[model samples]
Target: MSPTTDADLSDFVFVRRNDGLPIEEIPFELVERKGVGHPDTMCDAIAERASRYYSQYCLEHFGRIAHHWFDKVMLFGGESDLDYGHGELVNPYTVLFAGKGAHRCGDTPIPLADILRRAAADVLSEVTTGFDADRHLVIDCRIVDHQGAGRGRSRYRPESHDDLVAIGDPSLVSNDCNLLHAFAPFSRLEQAVLRIERLINGPDFKARHRDTGWDVKVFGSRNGEDFSFIVNMPFLASDISSFDHYLSRKAECREEVVGLLRDTLGGDPAVLFNPTDRNGRPYLTALGSVADTGDVGAVGRGNRVTGLITPMRAMSIEAPAGKNPLDHTGKLYGVLAQQLARRLNEMTGKPVETHLFTSKEAPLDRPDQVVVRVHGLQDGGDEEQKIRAVVAEALANTAELTREIIVTGVTMW
Candidate 1:
């Protein structure tokens, strides 16, 4: 049958079922309650620092043309899986980097492994005061051998043997304590998102984005269930009549999407939209969930007050634009960090610190169009109310700052 405006899209929607439970009844005590020194915290620090360093290095060396020479840098962080049955927690150490021209780092070989290891050690040392030297943290870097002995193809292959090197660890952690403790807060984020999705879309609404591919699965409470969402929106300039028509079309499409989502999973129906509309804006949304919640209650109930949702905006300025994209990204990130920290503190009635990162990628086709990635972090409490407030503030500030930047006519080419 031809797809109709009201036709259910459930067939296209994906579902993942498991014995895993939703975060609903999970006691709040199961979540870890530490502020810093958490594995996720450490990962955030490392990823931010590494991305910032890479961005700066590119700017200093390539100037306005840096984006043409850059690539993706994957930001990897988090702990190992926990073996609850065995009463052991395997604290997982991960290495994620992103950059442009990642496939062509075979020439002018850079010591990527060394850089990653150093970065990890520095991060660990900075986070862990008086860390036990006896507990040696093994940090290794190696190329991802995806092709099984030449039988498979590598996901990322350097164009020249002299390009940059790829580094990571193969030894996954194996432990007994609830490794979930290390990732409880993140789990809460997942729960909040899932609840919201189900409320607006339906219970069957599954996350459609992943690191490797576009796969859809229901939010679960088990290993490999952490959820994250990314929304990409575009602004357009059009007549009011056209804009109304566009909104109508968007609303119809959104309803169909949510209807299909509910049919697949049996969730409640709800819709979330930006309070303000943008002209010609295209949006992308991503979701992730955690599988375990060992200390959910201890940390705090997943209240909106303690949860936060923030968006980090990035723009690329091509060469000959009379500005450096890298420098501009750094400056913007700094501004975001400072502003977010102040705003979060005021909203939460608690002192807060913000983290920021800048990343660059080399243009494969357009040598002049440099791409800059900016990441920002804002702290929220463990309650739902607090989290929601933080997210609201962050989003408001981000939108304002983005508008200001565009109006100032700043360029980082």
Candidate 2:
């Protein structure tokens, strides 16, 4: 990809609606501070960690046997402020996972469910802490069987499978007192269906319309010739002044913001935009990429998945009398989170999931703000280094734009 300096800013400018409501940028600390122990954060961390571990297991153990093998996985979290009477619920958050992979033999093929489950279990074991084993840590694994005949000696055959394996289980041991018991005997196919349902019917789906007052939008697509990808961008005000302020301080906070973006949006560089009509507003853009295969069998062989996850500290749009003034600050952030997820999916040719979280409290210092954090897990031995390396690089690149915005006081709406 060309550097930002190389590209003409004119083509990249993104305009908002005619209304004066320009999008705004939110601090990463507000969204990512949920801490590692939070249920939602733990779920996301475990699911991705497990999926990656499983993928490596396949590559190491089955690479010699299968002609091709790979996996696509995603993690999501959600919460309702209405559940708690006053402040937002802090500890009991929901986490979800969707994963799929394929393996081919010379003529015969094997389902990868067994390997996926073991990997998931391994990840859960490594990450679970503080919470009771029975009530904390839930695992869901999905496997799609895409087995068929080879078109020709060199022709690619992208087969679509109808069979699925879905499994949901709790990482902790069972406790009688905990009513929120985990499911058992998880199936990979069932998990796949659940993931699809979330992609199409989850909260993010309801959050996509302009009238819905939602903060984000997500979209996705996949094909055999090319790899699957997801994109997550934000839609906000186009005023450049906000961008300027953000750029001015980018150096101080860029590392955390960019790191979060790369981890969430894949390796793609986050893009900042200035629409033609608005000289003062700016928005952020992110793209994810995947490989494309060539051959007759590869035609129409792909799965596109998109998910939107939004977490709000409060739902009331109107500020209460005699109360601290509400900021109404993070709505644009919710929207941007959705957009980034969609963009990443499109670019990578892989299934995509996006999440958004907001706080109702005007000043974020109040206990009302929702906190979120992310972590990764790897297989035993040498695999740990590889996972850390990928995550480290993503954090480094992600820091650039975030820091730039803070220091230069530049806004890319």
The best candidate by lDDT is 1
Stretches off by above 4 angstroms in model 1 are: 1-34, 64-107, 130-135, 140-413
> TM-score for every candidate vs. truth?
0.27, 0.25
> At residue 101, what lDDT does model 1 achieve?
21
lDDT tens digits, residues 1-413, model 2?
Answer: 12222122223212111222111112110111221222222333343344344434433544321212222232232221221112122222122233223443334354445544444444333322122223332334444334335323221122322121111111111111100001111122222222332332234532441111111222222121221222122222211134454344323232433344455444543322212215543222110000000001110011111111112112122111101011112322222232343343344333323332323321211112111111121225443233223222322232232223223322111
lDDT, candidates in the order shown: 0.29, 0.25
TM-score of 2: 0.25
lDDT of 1 at 326: 28
Error of 2 at 384 (Å): 39
- C-alpha root-mean-square deviation, each candidate: 24.6, 25.6
For residues 49-100, what per-residue lDDT tens digits would candidate 1 score against the true structure? 4434443443343321122111122223323232211111133234443332
